[model samples]
Structure formats: C-alpha cells, structure tokens
Target: MTIDLINDMIPPLKITDDATKALIWMEELRLHALPVIKDKKFLGFLTEEMIMDHNTVDAKAGDFLLKGENCFVFEYQHTYEAVKKATDFDFECVVILNDDNEYLGVVVLSDALSIFSQSASIQSEGGVIVLSLNQSDYSLSEISRLIESNEAQVMGSSLNIDKNEPTKFRLTLKINKIDLTHVIATLERFGYKVVAKYQEVKSISNEKERLDMLMRYLDA
Candidate 1:
C-alpha cells in the first residue's frame, strides 16, 4: 500500500494560511503545489501558478478557488493509483487519505517513483530480454514454456506495440536465471527475434540508469 510511502516532509497548508505562506512552503520544498487541510479533512491543493495568477499573496488559501480537489488516493490503495492521480492532474504530489476521507499525508511523485523502481520484481536479480514479433504471433504461454525448457522462469513481462512498426510488438521479459546464454539460443531457434538483452551482471547499474532516465523524462 501507498500508506508507507506518505512523505512527512510535505506539511499541509491550513485553509487559514495566506498565499504568501503557501508560496514559501512551495519554494522551500521545491514543489509546484501543496495540500490544504481543515479540521483533518482535505480541502484540495494550491499551486504556485494559481497564487501567482490571481496575485493573491496576502489572501487566505480558502479565499481563492483551489485546484486538484480530486488529486488523491486512499491510503490502502496501490501505488499505481497515486501515480495515476499525479499524472492525471499534473500534480507534483498526491494527497493520501484514510477510509473516511480524512487527510493522512501526501506522496510526492518522485518518492513514489523511487519506490516503484525498488519493487521486488524490478530489483530482483534477473536477465531481461526483448523480443520483436508480429502482433498475431504473440503467445505468452508458448513463450513461457520455451523459457522454462531452458530451466529459466519468466518472472515478469511487458508487451508494447513496436513504435517503428505498426504490426510488430516488443515483448520484454524478465527471466529468473542470470545466465541467458541458453535461453537466448532457445528463443532464436524457435524463430523469436531477440532485439535486446540485458544480462544480470549489469542489473544494478541498469536499474539506476533506468530510474535516472525516467526522472528526466518526467521532468521533460
């Protein structure tokens, strides 16, 4: 659950607080927005741009219309829900609430992303392989069987349409075994085109690199 990912560093702004105070918090925390709470209930979020647009530095947060009222996820919800809310509203962070809709805390997007990168399936020591094949030829069961024949299990997999070819798809798989020499040969013998492969030796470095690339992409 995302409850554990709640960031205590992001203090909520009271409804009575002025926009100037909100701006100060935003600046100090390097955030674009901050949550507003009243009597333990989440009112919404106030953005730096919103304050600047209305020139309401001295106005109380409740005085002006707030944004991202729905930019929140229940504490027991999956981390993906938090990521979805942040992305859907272009928010820097998402408010976390309890079952009764009471404010708990906020989860910064960057923090949630870091946790996602460290998920068991992602951090597991494994070899990754990307296969390019026609959309019509996709068969996960067959693929898994072939991989198992090599004494390797498919830990996880993702399929996406090949950006360069409309009719082709890229199937990326994470295998349990670090040594993929036999796996690759077995796949190729079955006419599966292995487009890319990442051996286990570089798993640590590659995970860090992937996280860095994702952060850059999000910034852009």
Candidate 2:
C-alpha cells in the first residue's frame, strides 16, 4: 500500500499572518519553519531565523524573505520525492500542493524519515553494502545480476554522488540476507569496490532473544 501523505501534514501560516504569530506557531510545533500560503497559493516558507533577524514582531509574514518558495511537491507525488526535496533544500519540512496549486499542507522531515524507516524494504531482513564506482561504470542491472547470481536479491538501492569526488558515485544496496561475505567477494571479483557493509546482527539477536524467552515460558 502507498503511504498517505496527508498523515504527515503540518499546518501552514497565511502570508497575511503576523510574523510574531508565525514564530509562535513554529515554536509551538517545534519546527524551524512553516509554509506561507496566500489565497490557497503557497507563497513561501517563513523561518524562525528570518523572524529573529527581522527583529520586528508586528510585521506581516510577507515582509520577510521566505526560504522555500519553489521547494514543494505535488500531493500525489511519492513520499520519497518529498524527502529528497527536504534534503536538497536543507529544509525542516517541504510544502505539499494539489494539482490546482492549492496549498494542502507541509511534510515534516522527521515524519518523512519515520515513515521511510517503516517501509517494506527497510523492515525486511537485509544487509547493506556500499560500493564506490565511477559514474560511467554505474549499472543497476549488472549489479542486480551479480547479486542474484550469488543467490541474494537486492531489496533496495540508493545512489549518491560523492561530494569530494564529483566523478564518483556511491551506491548503497540492501541485500535480502545478513551474511554478505560471499556477496562482497562476488562484487569485488567483478571489480566493484566495496566501501562499507552493514549486517543485520543486532536485529537477528533481538529476535533470537525473544524466541528464547517464549521457549522458556512454554517449558515452564
């Protein structure tokens, strides 16, 4: 099932609202910024720093420069898009809009992350493998084939361009098994540079402990 975007909505502030009121809302909601809407059109984001810098409580929200005027996603867009926008803008939240450009609400960064962590791929039993490769050599199909050949399926994958090395990319993969020794060897053998690996040891240990407790109760 798809995630319900409305479930993560944060209220908005009208452009005509007082700057002080916006700041109050930000503080009450424990957020650094809030989306500003005028006539159902998202104008921009009102941030606490802007309010503090303006040093005037009586001014309208429109008086200050809003941060994320273009930082928004359509309501029907996947939640991953919202998360990506938030990251790209370093925003505390991203604005959401309807097809008509009507202001819907805002998606808090923390809420998006919480929802993402509960996704099927994340909840599944898996191990993570990070590989560094040149942008030109990146191929998902080839990587998936290599992983499948080793009897392991790729549960999920994310690609990030290396900041220090613009020509290089970092590929993170979630494999369906905790033991990645063979997978690492296989990838290395194919000339894929393995940068890091994360196994599901703690989760497996916790599950085992719970099962043992259940067995003890049954025996008693």
Candidate 3:
C-alpha cells in the first residue's frame, strides 16, 4: 500500500524562534532536532546539541548555523525515500516540501521506521529464507520458477550486496508456506546456496499452547 506522506508530518519551527524554545519543543516531542522554516520555505534543521555547544539558547534559530538544509524529500516521494534520506544524512528526521518548494513538515526517523515495520511485506505471514549467490548467477525469474516448482510462491524478496565480497549478493526471500524444506531443496538443486532460514513453527506452537490454556480455563 502507498504511504500518505502528509500524515507523517511533524510540525516545524520558525527560523526566528529562540534556541531555548527549540530545545523545549525537542524535549516535549522527544526529538533530537527540528526543521526551521521561513515564509513557508525550509531553511534547515536546528539541533539541541548544536545550540548547547554554541551556548546559543537565547539566540534565534536563524542566527545559528543549521544543518541538513538539503536533506529533504518531496511530499510525493515514497516513505522509503524519506528513510533513506535520514539514514544517508545521519539526520534525526527528513524535511518535506511541496511541488511549489513550500515547506510541508518533517518525517522523524522513528516514525518512518514504524511505518516500515508495519508495511505489508514486513507484516506478511511467511517463512524467510536467505541465500548467498554470485551476482552473475542471480536471476529473479529463475528463482521464482524454482520456488513455484516446489508448490510455494515467493511472497516478497530483498537483496543486499555482500559486505565481504562485492561480487556476491545476499538474497532474502519471504515464502508463503511455513514449511520450506521442499523450497530449499529446489533452490539448492538449481545451484543456489541457502544461507539461513526462519520458519513459523515455534510461533505456531506457542499459539496452540495459548489456545489450549484458554480452553482449560473456560472448562474450569
């Protein structure tokens, strides 16, 4: 599902606002930094540590040097883009703007993470399998076909470059079935190396135990 960027908007601060007020707002909102705007234009971000380091509590936000002025995303951008921007800039939040270049608000890293965790792919009920493969040998269509041959479908998948080997990649797949024995066999038969696997059997067992306890309590 598409994310509504505007709904994640965190209120911004005016450039003329005092650093002390900014600090108070940060404390109240549990934010490390906040965006500074002027005439609906985003100037930059002001951090509590920056103010404390400069001893500029009484100074206006505009009077101090702000950071991450260019660290922003358009309102139409995806939520992942905001997360990426925040991670790339090492910023506490990501600024948002409209098509007209007007300041909208900021998306806090914490909120972005929450949205990401609740995303469909993440919340889907499935078993996860991680595979290590050479870049040249990687073909998504081939992998899907192998999975389908085992009567299992890939629910979702992600890839990351192997840190130790630039020519290799780590592929993570979410499979619809909790039992992945057949899927793993099929992939390995096709020369795919299975690195790790996670199943829902433990969770299912726990749930069954809880249901049994509930039934016993009802009978008592």
Candidate 4:
C-alpha cells in the first residue's frame, strides 16, 4: 500500500510568507522540514536546518531563499520511492504533484517510513491464505480454532471486505510448518474456507514497486 496522508498538508510558501511563523509551525508540527509548493507544483522543501542556519533575526525563509536540497515529487509517485528519497536526502517531506506537476499533496518522511516499516513487517512475518467460503457460511472463530488446534497462529487478518456477490477473507497466518498440514485438513473438513496459499509468499512486487516509488519520490 502507498503512504498517502491528508493531515500531512503544510501551507505552501509558508517559509517565504512568514519565516518566523514558519519556524513556529515547525515547532508546533515537530517537523524537521515542510514542503513548499506553488501553482500545484512541488517547488521545494523548507528545512529546519536552513531556518536555524540563517537565524531568525538576520533571515526569514525568503531571505535565505534556499529550499531543502531542492527536493520534491508528484502524486503518482510510489510510496517506496518516496521513502528512498526521504531516506537518501534525509528530507522531512516529499511534496506530491500531478501529471502537469500540479501540487496534489505531500508525503511526510515519517509517514512513508511508517508505511514501509509496516509493509516490511507484514511481508516478513505474514502469510496470506485464500479461503473459499459461501457468504452464508462465514465464521472467524471456527477458522481461528482450527488454526490453533493445529498449533498455528493468526497474527493479523484482513478480509476483502469487498461486498461482491461472493465475499472472501484473506487471512494472514503466522504458523509453524508442523501444524500447517493439519490446519489445512481441519479447515477443509469443517467447511471452512481454504482457497490459495500464499505461504511465505513475499510480496516481492510490492517491495520492488515500493523501492522504485521511494526512488521517484526523491528524484522527482
């Protein structure tokens, strides 16, 4: 999943408009840097280091007129790409844009990191189990019991929750291989769902795409 956040918005050109106030914004938001955009285009980022380097008495954001490493990005930019850029430059924000380079939003490095870390964790420890069950025949506890009965464990779960004609829940299981066979058998016998097994299936594509995404987030 991409790391997109609405609350990450910081006013465009806040540094130029009021350097002193922008400093205050940094304090309030506890952000090391913020995106500076204009006309929906990601222009650059205003950083805390720059602010402090100039000093409040002698310079404002516009006075120094230097943005954070001249970094920026577009909306379609992938989340992992954003993370890599943020990581490389140590930037605080990755401003997002559109096809015409119109500013759509911003991605906080922390937010992107949060997303990447979560994705990494899930991919490393989670297993996807595709279960085939009728809409009228859905039971979470029974599945849990079967898993536990086989000495397996479900770490976290997410259902398609897509209310299509036939609903499906893709469960994430963290289990020992010893119990996997029994768990599968019990599930099949109990009329519980068992469709496909993404066991130890790393979302490699997600990783690749995300990595590229972070790259773009930085380079763009």
lDDT tens digits, residue span 187-213, model 2: 999999998787654442343343332
Candidate 2 error regions (>4 Å) = 1-11, 27-30, 37-43, 49-55, 68-78, 84-90, 97-104, 134-137, 165-168, 203-220
lDDT-best of 2 and 4: 2
Error of 3 at 150 (Å): 2.4
138-194, model 3: which lDDT tens digit per residue?
899999999988888887676767656778988878788888899999889879999
Per-candidate RMSD, Å: 6.0, 9.2, 9.4, 11.3
Q: Tell me the tens digit of each residue's lDDT in model 1 across 112-196.
A: 7777577555667778788889998999999999999998899767676786787998887878888899999999999999988
> Which runs of model 4 end up more than 4 angstroms from their true locations?
1-3, 6-9, 57-60, 120-220
Model 4 agreement with the true structure over 1-220: per-residue lDDT tens digits:
2335534446656434656676777788888776665455555677778777776744545555556443555556566555555666776666666667666666776666546546543445444455656656667777788888876776644444323333644343444342356778888887765655545534435545545433332332
For every model in order, what is the number of clashing pairs? 0, 0, 0, 12
Predicted structure 3, TM vs. truth: 0.63
Misplaced by over 4 Å in model 3 are 1-9, 123-146, 157-172, 177-220
Best by TM-score: 2
TM-score of each candidate?
0.63, 0.68, 0.63, 0.50
Identify the superior model by TM-score, candidate 3 or candidate 4: 3
RMSD of 2: 9.2
